[model samples]
Target: MKRIIPFILALLLLAACGAEPVEAEASPPPPMPTASPLPDYIPPMDFEPVSVWQAEHFSGRALLYLGAEEDGVTPFKVYSCFMYEVTDYLDGNMLMGARAFCAEAADSGDFSVDCSNRGLWLEPVLGASALTGKLSVDGDRLTLEYTGCELAAWAEDTPGFEYRLSGGQPVIDSGTGENDSVQYLPTEFKRLPDEYLGRAMYWMPMFEEEASASAESVRGLRVGDTYADIVARFPNPLDIWSRDPRSVSAPDGWYDTFYGSEAGTVFAALFYEGGVPSTVLITCCSYASFQLDGGLNITQLSVSAR
Candidate 1:
């Protein structure tokens, strides 16, 4: 009886020691935060300014002279003075050019003359026909004074109206008992496209060359080509200004389109008929007008170079 009692006590102690421990439950990790979505991105508009050119148009009687002496001076019926700042694209050259329209019969009742062909010239300085002038700048204003400037009616009619500038002002001797002076001021100025001005003034010859090349390349685009095909052929244009369908004119329809750079150094106009190109006009330092047939084939090509 005593041996059986001792064995039972030892078995109970072994069972308690072998039992597993009870552990407290652990809390799950805090849930991760939801990420916020980002806003959509929009592209900015492209704009690049190349240079500054300003002109002032004046009517009525105005005297234009180069230097002090008024030799070879002819009275102008109409006058237009211009100032060009080519420092941005050119080698910091400031030039002045003027156009004076002289009427053959001042009393013939007509004061109109075509001044479109008249070209700009570098205002002479001190009896010299220099290509550029000295520029002076004030607040919102620029003054270009020429020493020995030359004035003329046009390229064809010229002995060269030569005179010396006294105070950057022209002495308007009306010869009617009135002596008044007029100064050039650029109050109303318009910023012209850099490309156009560069080609027109011969400031950037390479721009002209590139424009010519682009025009020639685009000419290969046949009249039957789609707008997509045209874009594929000529990828980068300055911009596509127009893309309106000809709904009213023809049921087949057409589109009048213009493509060029911001400066307008070179540009092309494509007229699409029946959703196909019919005509293409390219202008770069000159103009090339192309007419196409119904098959988008080149039928007529007229090119003019300046």
Candidate 2:
């Protein structure tokens, strides 16, 4: 009975040693968080190109008018014009021996024509004439059509070419006399600077004699006036500030100071050389910076909103 018991115990121990061990379960990774979307962004409005005119000029050729629409609630039109006299025509549609004939505003009647050395070239007489045509642009070409007598006369004039007159008006024939076409290539045209456009808008109302007269007077501050003189002119001045010439590496003798009105609206800058007031710059909302140099002499003026 004791031998039987020992054999049975040995059999039970062998069975327990042959059994496999158990393992722990692995945990799932935490769920990733969702990302949020961003807000929409809007851009500013773009400046629109209005009209462009191209014509033959004395120096070569010139873009007579380039117009652009100002960016604002109120619509303001601004344009620039350059006039030229064509001396000769070369191959590849190039004008030879051309000169700067004039500079003018296409919309406004104000213009400056260079009449110096008028007797030199008298054959193809090109004068300062207002731009006349229905200006349009297609793809990259700028087209200007000279229709009727008014446009034809301004387009070109030869030494002895006769105009086919009808009913006391010049007769314009299609693809022939009177009617003319001017096309400007991309290389020939250019965009006027924004400063000039701003200047044009500012001076739009200066056509009146009263406005011009008022502009001439710089709040009773004339050129050649000393700093003390200017101070005396404005009893209750708003603010006064100075800029050190040495800080700017300027060799000028004294510091430059700017004075303004009490309301912080009107401002004027005085420049000094050798301790004498050499220049004065007056600024107003309506006009550009009016400057007087040579002891307060009004030498430089720029009227611009920007």
Candidate 3:
């Protein structure tokens, strides 16, 4: 038997693009001109603040500036933080930044604040841990002194910056309070999957006979003896579609045939595909609801209310 030895080979290719060195002497081109500074370099500060705050024991820093009152009267509070892109400021300089406010309250622990962001609430750190008596922004840093301790924070005009705790020798991270540096970044809240509905659902065809039954029962409703006929089965009797978009009162005798008189007749939503009955959404109460998952392909005469 002749055995075949298949030849396999791998090729490696390397390409380099470079300029060849020239021995010919030539005058060097004049040094490229440097760009002149802008005539309107100082853009006026429009401090018409879009937000304000009052906070305490503030650790984390965001797009806005954060601070507390210097008075030793109140506990601690955190107001609001600003949000902005970090790339819009001088490179590596703290020229651009945001600001927030803070207040103190004795009734609730040592830390409390009434600001635009959190409204009115108590912060986590309390008493001596409240961080400062009050806070304010001086140029690029937030300056504050509390409980015989003083600290400064440096933040750029950018959105998310790593804020290191100012003052003292041990060194500390502002938000985490750990000896290890902590970084604060910008983020936004997410939304629910469905609107007003507590759960997710899907619609599909039920048993084949059920759809045929619907098609038959709805035959004489001025629709062809087809999927169109199934849709005509559900008619708008009183035509109450002009009501308000929020509240709706069910019509009398609406559910008499299905749920009986005790079921409290109410209006339900009917869905159709290609002008044919497909799904029915029924509301039992403000919270509880049912979805009839069936199309023209239905069969057995039964309703599973969930």
Candidate 4:
């Protein structure tokens, strides 16, 4: 009976020591969300070729420039600029208007950096405090988006303070596209009355009377008059240039001179009415010129000093 009992105990121990296969449970991977494509309504850049009128409401040729990241990067940044030529508005007070300046992040960079880097050059025309907002490039349209900025420095004497002078809207040129060569349009036409035409050319000069000797003014003299005559009667000019009616070009050597110097230069000339000299207008430096209503007047003029 004892031997049988020992044998039974050994059998039970062997059965208890036998091994069995165990199963393992795996962990599930984290989920990944799909990304959506960019919207179709937005353009690649803001600056597209277009026509813009002058402060005087005369038609002028306009072109825009936009700088964006060519390299592929997220949350891209951009810079924008504008160039316009007014040929025949305001009796040619301004031959052209050019604006090349940039606005950085509202939260990034020193505020005066813009002034030193770009605004100082454009301030005379655009005002020093005018640098406000991010320039957006939406394909062919150039949009100037204001960053909720309101400072006394940007305020102008004009009615409503014309924020377009300071901020707002896209200056679009419908004529230019991806394949088209850029060009400007004239602000004025050939047929116009003398008094109105004289006003067109002489208005800015007339308004400038209150300015001190440091400020520049225009003198209406005959075409045949010598340079001495120009200097003797009018205030001393910082610089002078002559305009050719045939080509609508100034001695500043056409558009090339304007681009090269980047300095503010003036073009002066005598216009004839009924075969008689009528008025003398100064061609204020700008980027483009266009024919709009009467004779060639400057629709856009650059006030910045290089």
Report lDDT (CA) for all predictions: 0.34, 0.31, 0.25, 0.29
Question: All predictions: root-mean-square deviation over Cα?
Answer: 24.7, 27.5, 31.7, 31.2
**Worst ten-residue run, lDDT, model 2?**
202-211
Top-lDDT structure, candidate number: 1
List ranges where model 3 is wrong by over 4 Å: 1-76, 80-102, 105-128, 136-143, 146-164, 167-306
lDDT of 2: 0.31
Which portions of model 4 show Cα errors greater than 4 Å? 1-59, 68-98, 104-113, 116-125, 128-130, 137-142, 148-306
List clash counts for every candidate, in order: 14, 13, 34, 33
Identify the candidate with maximal TM-score: 1
TM per prediction: 0.27, 0.23, 0.17, 0.26
lDDT string, candidate 3, 187-266, tens digits: 21112222211111001111111222332221122111222222223223344322221122334323211111112212
* Global lDDT of model 1: 0.34
- Tens digit per residue, CA lDDT, model 1, 156-222: 2433333334543432211212111112322223334544422222221111222334434333433
Quote model 4's TM-score.
Answer: 0.26
Error at 135, model 1, angstroms? 1.7
Give the lDDT ranking, best first. 1, 2, 4, 3
lDDT tens digits by residue: candidate 4, 1-306: 989999999999888789565567655322222212212111123333122211212233222222233333113222121233332333322233333333333323212214332232233223334334444333433343443322235333322332232222323222212111111221112222323321222222211111211222223323333333332332223333233233343343233231211222333344444433233333333211221112323222222212
lDDT of 3 at 170: 16
